[model samples]
Target: MRLRYTTLVVDDYDAAITFFVDVLGFELVEDSPATTSTTGAAKRWVVVRPPGADTGLLLARADGERQRAAVGDQFAGRVGHFLEVDDAAAEYERLVALGVEFEGPPRVEAYGTVAVFRDVAGNRWDLLSGP
Candidate 1:
């Protein structure tokens, strides 16, 4: 079976949508009201995807303390996500111009060219492209 979406917890839905759509250049695939929970809080099922990607990201809002704490530390401060690009250098330069903060500069490796950058929520992501 093919994987569809991976959940990325966020502090706010609109903010996450803004980052994914406006900053990262993803398309908002869905944003509809979700099933009501026991807590009686309003929730929405949000999904976003890259320009032409098969897999998309599901944005989940922090509902409690534990979830809130995990907003930016989903993978405990490691490079938890990766976006394979057509050109690492070009993407790096474009992201930099848009004010995205990267952990360091892009470097070529035996497998590919890669650079580490942070999402708006501070989750680390690797932008890479094969040689």
Candidate 2:
């Protein structure tokens, strides 16, 4: 069986959509009305994925206090995601031009070129290039 979507808690749906689709060049796979399974609260089933990617991110809006608190800290302040790109330097520059926050400039690592950047939700991700 193939893996499908990974849930990403966000402060807002539209904002997250914009960040992933517009800023990060991900495609909007789906965005439709939905409801919370626990309380039947209104929500949206929003999914986005990188171009040609098999896995997609399901953007779920923070539902309550605990979830809200976990929005950007899903990984507990670590680099929880790695975004593989063909050209790390170019992608890093492009993301910076789009106002994305980077912890530092891109540096060459033993494996490849890498840079740390934060998503709109404040989750850290590594922009990596190479095998």
Candidate 3:
């Protein structure tokens, strides 16, 4: 079976959408009205994904203080997400030009070339290439 979407808590929906669509070159798969399953509060069902990727990200806005605090630290300050690309250096440069913040320059690892960068929500992601 294939994986579906992963929930990404964000501070704002439109801002997250802009970052994924305009900056990261992902497609907006869906952005429809929804509600919280627990409280039936109004919410949104927003999904974004890389052009040819099977798994997309569900952008869920922070609903409360606890969720809000988790928005950028979902992985507890570790590099939690990975964005694989064909050319790590090129993608790194492009993202830098687009104002994406990188922790450091690209470096080579035994497995691949990679660079860590923070997403719009401050979650660290590895811009990776190679095997």
Give the C-alpha lDDT of model 1: 0.91
Model 1, 1-131: lDDT tens digits are 89899999999899889988998899999999975576777899999999989899999998889899999999998999899999999989999998999988899999899999988788999999998
**Which lDDT value does model 2 have at 50?**
97
In candidate 2, stretches whose alpha carbon ends up further than 4 angstroms from where it belongs are none
Tens-digit lDDT string for candidate 3 (1-131): 88899999999999999999999999999999999999999999999999999999999999989999998999999998899999999999999999999999999999899999998999999999995
lDDT of 2: 0.96
Task: Count residue pairs with overlapping backbones in model 1.
Answer: 0
Ordering by TM-score: 2, 3, 1
Better of 1 and 3 by TM-score: 3
Worst lDDT 10-window in candidate 1: 34-43
Per-model TM values vs. the true structure: 0.94, 0.97, 0.97
Q: In order, what lDDT does every prediction score?
A: 0.91, 0.96, 0.96
**Which run of 10 residues does model 2 get worst, by summed lDDT?**
122-131
lDDT of 3: 0.96
- Clashing residue pairs in candidate 1 are none
